[model samples]
Target: MAGTIQRHPVSPVSALRLFFVAGWRSNLALFRWMRPSAFIPTLIGVPALQLIFFVHLGRYLDTQPVSYYALGNALHACAMAGLFAPAMSLAGERFAGTLPALLATPANRTLMFAGRTVTAVLVGCSSTVVMLILGSVLTDFRLPAEGIVPISAAILVTAASCSAFGLLVGAAGLRTREAILLGNLVLYLMLLVCGINIPRESLPDGLRLIGEIMPMTHGIAAARQAFTGSGPVTGLLLVELGKGLSFLVLAVLTLRFLERGSRRAASLDEV
Candidate 1:
């Protein structure tokens, strides 16, 4: 009794505040170890390097490689980051022994989970802006003045959609320890099938069919349209937003289901 640690019940208001704070701190912790040199290389440099590679490679084959790669890769970075961050958060919470408490809290699960995911969505959006700025600087390409509004809107939708999908992945992650691996797998799958480097039509028929259901497929097209000042196809943006909503609904249901099972098994603390 003397050595026992006292644990106080967290008030709903306090839990909500901590929920948002945890999201911010978790995202910050992700980059804390990486000094600018290392962090920049991964976050900004890799995409810039990829842009350069495509620019040079396109020189031999085409006159407008920047047009092809700049927007695509920028959007790719944003989509992937948004898509994985929440999932990684779930895995981290599990490993840290905080997930069960968070999930089991009397607080509204939807509000709590959404609060925790906001930073990741913002990270995704900021990454998109950074990649676009970097790509423009490193190449002849530039963001069109007229396209700015449309592009910004498209970026927001892409980030939102990917964040929802990531939340779904996080919910599923409650059942397994491999959430991070699942996140990476989804990221690469999107890269290949979402037309990041190649046209979606160029994909094999089977993969193309699969790509249609992927989170960022329509969002990427909207991104390209935004770059051209053609206006984001409203249908595409709607589809992306719809997909995100559907994923969020699915995540909520999955989390509820898993919670039921965990309660029966009395294994909420199990990682």
Candidate 2:
């Protein structure tokens, strides 16, 4: 029994089972690790920047809307946080050979993915709430007492969307360092094009149209309308909710396709 153990290659279903076990355990590790790394920045730096940019230096800018930027910044932090947290963690696992071992196990892929996605959502929301409380305490931002609920929904939805996309990118580009770079670059472009820092109306007509398609476009606008408005929350809720789910579904499908292809080509453990 001790002689060189010939490992029976795992079937697709067995591999998926292993993946779920590893993914969940990995997610818990992520939960513990990301607190100081990702959460701290989302809690302090990003939200403080929002307060500083709007409250301190916002008036001097040309027609820059503070109320709009507040919630925009919040969405920005959620997006950035999702990108920074789960993707980086996945990359680390890939480097450590955890992913191939995971795929070789017997866990369900859907359960595996759900655990990772849920981790991203929960962590993203926790950090977002800290940002919200910071905004309320440090700035003139006025939100509905019940506003926390919708904002949280938006944050979790957005985080799931981003994390799913990250998983796709991470899996597909495991060999290249471009995954993180590309994600952050896309995030930066989204920040600019999505009318977060500046109104879409201020952009050229063609650019304005492009901005509308970005997830950040709908996410930021919807979040802003909810954060500083005395009006109905239904519209913003619908926009963020619907669009966020769409992005998440698309991203998950991308992950599913990419994972199958990736496994067909090579396992994560192979050089």
TM-score for each predicted model, relative to the true structure: 0.83, 0.75
The TM-score of predicted model 2 comes to: 0.75
Give the alpha carbon lDDT tens digit for every residue of 13-89 in model 2: 76665555555577666546546785566545765676556544555663665556566666666666566555666
Local lDDT at 205 for model 1? 96
In terms of lDDT, which candidate is strongest? 1
Q: Would you give me the overall lDDT of model 2?
A: 0.62
Runs off by more than 4 Å, candidate 1 = 1-22, 25-42, 58-60, 63-65, 230-232
C-alpha root-mean-square deviation, each candidate: 4.7, 5.5
Steric clash count of candidate 2: 8
**Which pairs clash inside model 2?**
14-105, 16-107, 17-106, 17-107, 17-108, 18-105, 18-106, 18-107
Error of 2 at 13 (Å): 18
